[model samples]
Structure formats: structure tokens, C-alpha cells
Target: MLPRRSRLTGASSSDRGLPNATVARLPLYLRALTQLRSQGSQTCSSDQLAESTGVSSANVRKDLSHLGSHGTRGVGYDVDHLRAEIAQAIGQTQDWNVVLVGAGNLGTALAAYPGFTSRGSRIVAVVDADPARVGEQVGDLSIESIDQLETIITERSVSIAIVATPGQAAQDVADQLVGAGVTSILNLAPVALRVPEGVDVRQVDVAAELQILAYHEQRKGHPREEAEVSR
Candidate 1:
């Protein structure tokens, strides 16, 4: 286990000065490092890691530098050491309890996602109102009834909740989660949720990206013609 102080150190306000974009890319770097580690690579150069993660070598070096200089001048970074440092920096070294509400298809997929387990986040409970699906198995855990949410959350101390129901139920579920003491939420439904002060809510719309892509495609095919000259 990593020391509590070390876990808190990397997330200090000073470190948050790093650009949000860079912070978002940390997971990609960490995933690449995990893959390399699993393959028995003990050491790796920035170029090698860049090839695997598709990040530029310069960018990789710059991102790693933010967490402090962990690479050697001639030999590149030590894989295990870098992995531990990155994991700790991302708060993955400590366990985080999460709850998943609305066990529909997308919810099921999230419940079975292996990425969360590898990181420190664990889905300790799955909640759904459908009685038919309540006892169903998702990955290693059994789906739980929604009525048990408060008890389960209190028992697990769930700080995060993932809302995966339809847009109509999104806000209701979010309200319930907030009521049950969740401070952070990852909302998959299309609806925007209103939470109290200090609570965090992040929405992930699956079709929004498609709409952006379609908009770009239309612009490409119907390019604005240059201004014509008169005569």
C-alpha cells in the first residue's frame, strides 16, 4: 500500500496547475505503461513509449516531467518505478469505492469493465429498480435492488456514483445518489443533473461525439467557396 501522505501529495492544489488536457492524458500514459509492464519490459525509452501510446516522444517527456524527473539521461525511464509514480500521482494507489445505478446494457458494460479494477476504483454495488434484473450477475458481483442503495453506500463509503439509466431517470437517480452521500458523479444519461454545492457531476453523452463528427463531415463536403469576383 502507498503511504497516505504520498497519495495526498500528488493531488495538491499546486500540482493541479497542470493543464486539464495533460491531466486527461495521464490515464493513456498509465495504460501504456501497464501494457509494457505486463509484457516484461523493465525499461523503456520515450520513443518506444510514444510508439505504443501514440503520444509524441516530446509530449511524453514533458508530461512525465510534471510529476518530477524520473527518467535517466542515457537509459530512459525505469518501467516499474515510473508506473508506481504515475499510479500514485493519479490517486490509483488508494482504493475508491463507486456505485453504479441503473443496470441496463451500458450499465452492465460499465459494471464489467476491467479498467476500473486495475485502477484503484472499484464498483462495490450495482443498483437497479427492475425486480427481474435485481439478482442478475454482472461480472463478479450480483446486481442489487435500488432500495438498498443507502445501506450499501454507507457500508462501502461510496464517494462516486455512475448514472447509466435512461435520460428520464438520470436526474432522479442522481438525486438519490446525492441524497445517499455521493460527492462525485459520472452521468452517462443525456440529461443534465443539478447537484448541491461542492458536489461534482460529469456527463458522458455517447451520441454527442457522433453529432460532432457529422457536423465536420458536412463542412468538408460543402466547403465555403472563396468569394467570387465580379466583372
Candidate 2:
């Protein structure tokens, strides 16, 4: 399967001038820059950024070059300036209202996560199909009926949604979200969503990720067997 491109990055390489790899790494650069800024770092070299982000200095320079940033010969990139540039590149400068669908355990936790606001996307509403959950509060916002989904989205001008429904209900929730004008979705359900061309879906499957880590652990546990197989 082809890797999904994140809408948070604004545009694809085809639309913007950056390569796919550079676009993906922009977030890493921004994160490292954020940490540096917090530490009072005014300027940072390519090597410093590469070390912080676990990317090679050469790749760091190459990636920054795509943004028309070539650090000074003796100095380096200004941390504040780099952060602003990456923020603009990734559409973090703009506020993105998001709606959370499904008030189950996963959905509830997602609604309370503070990282979304820090990343420029805030969950403005939460909804679920369960009547019992409708009046419950996940954070500061009271849960609403899933029947009010479209209304909440339109009223808030929400363009992004988080789908934390069960695997069986994921597709349906995705359909509703798309129909309500959501262009981007962060899906935590196990099932993959099928949306139209313009819509973007990014799935986060914790169990699947853990299984991948288990595969690597198995390889480490049987290193001799793995080596023989390589032969």
C-alpha cells in the first residue's frame, strides 16, 4: 500500500516544491527546533539538528535547502526563524477546528489530549451514537449525540475529524465525516477508511504498531537463525 500523505503538511511535493521525504521530515525539524528554542538556543547547526532528530547532517542540510535555507557559513540557522518557516510550511500557522466522533474509551481519551491544540488543531466537539454517553463530559466539552454530527461540524466550521469508533463502525463514521465537509481525518479504529480523492485519512493502529515491534524483537531473539536465513 502507498504511504498516506498528511494534510497537516498543507500540500504534497507535487503541489508544493518540497520532496516527499523533506515534507515528512519537516515536522521532525520543527519539533527539534521547538525543543531548542525552549532551551534558549538562538542558532543551531545542521549537525545539531541532525543529532536532535536522529537524521544525518547531510540529509538535514538537504532538507533545509528545499526551504531555501542554507545556514550561514560560520553560524547556523536561527531557531526561531526555522520554527516559523516550518510552522508555515506545515500549515500550523492556521487554526484547524476538529470534531471527535465516538465517545468510547479511545475517543474520550483522544478528545482530552492536549497535543492537538499545540499542533494547531483543536477538537471543538465530541459526539457518539450511544445515548448514555451523550451528556457525559470528556474534558471541558459535553458529549453530543452522533445525530448532531453534521450540525456541530458545520456550526464550528470543522475541517478535520478524529474517528475513534469501533472497527465495524469506522467506515460509517468516516462516511458521515466526509459528507459533513471534513477534508482530513485521524482514524484510530482498526479498519481502513475508503474516502474520495480529495479527503485525507491518517490511521493510527497501536496494536498493529506493537505487532511490528514484536517482529523486530523476534528477529533479535533468533539472530543466528536470521543470519543463516540471510545467507
Off by over 4 Å in 1: 1-19, 223-231
The collision pairs in model 1 are: none
lDDT of 1 by residue, 139-205 (tens): 9889999999999999988999999999998888888888889999999998889999989888899
Candidate 2 lDDT, 1-231, residue by residue in tens: 333333344233355457878878998999899899999999999999999999999999988866656778889998998888789877899889999898888888888888778777888999988898888888989999999999999999999999989999999989999998899999999998999998988889999999999999999999799889978
The TM-scores of all predictions, comma-separated, are 0.82, 0.89
Ten contiguous residues minimizing lDDT sum, candidate 2:
1-10
Residue 151 in model 2: lDDT: 94
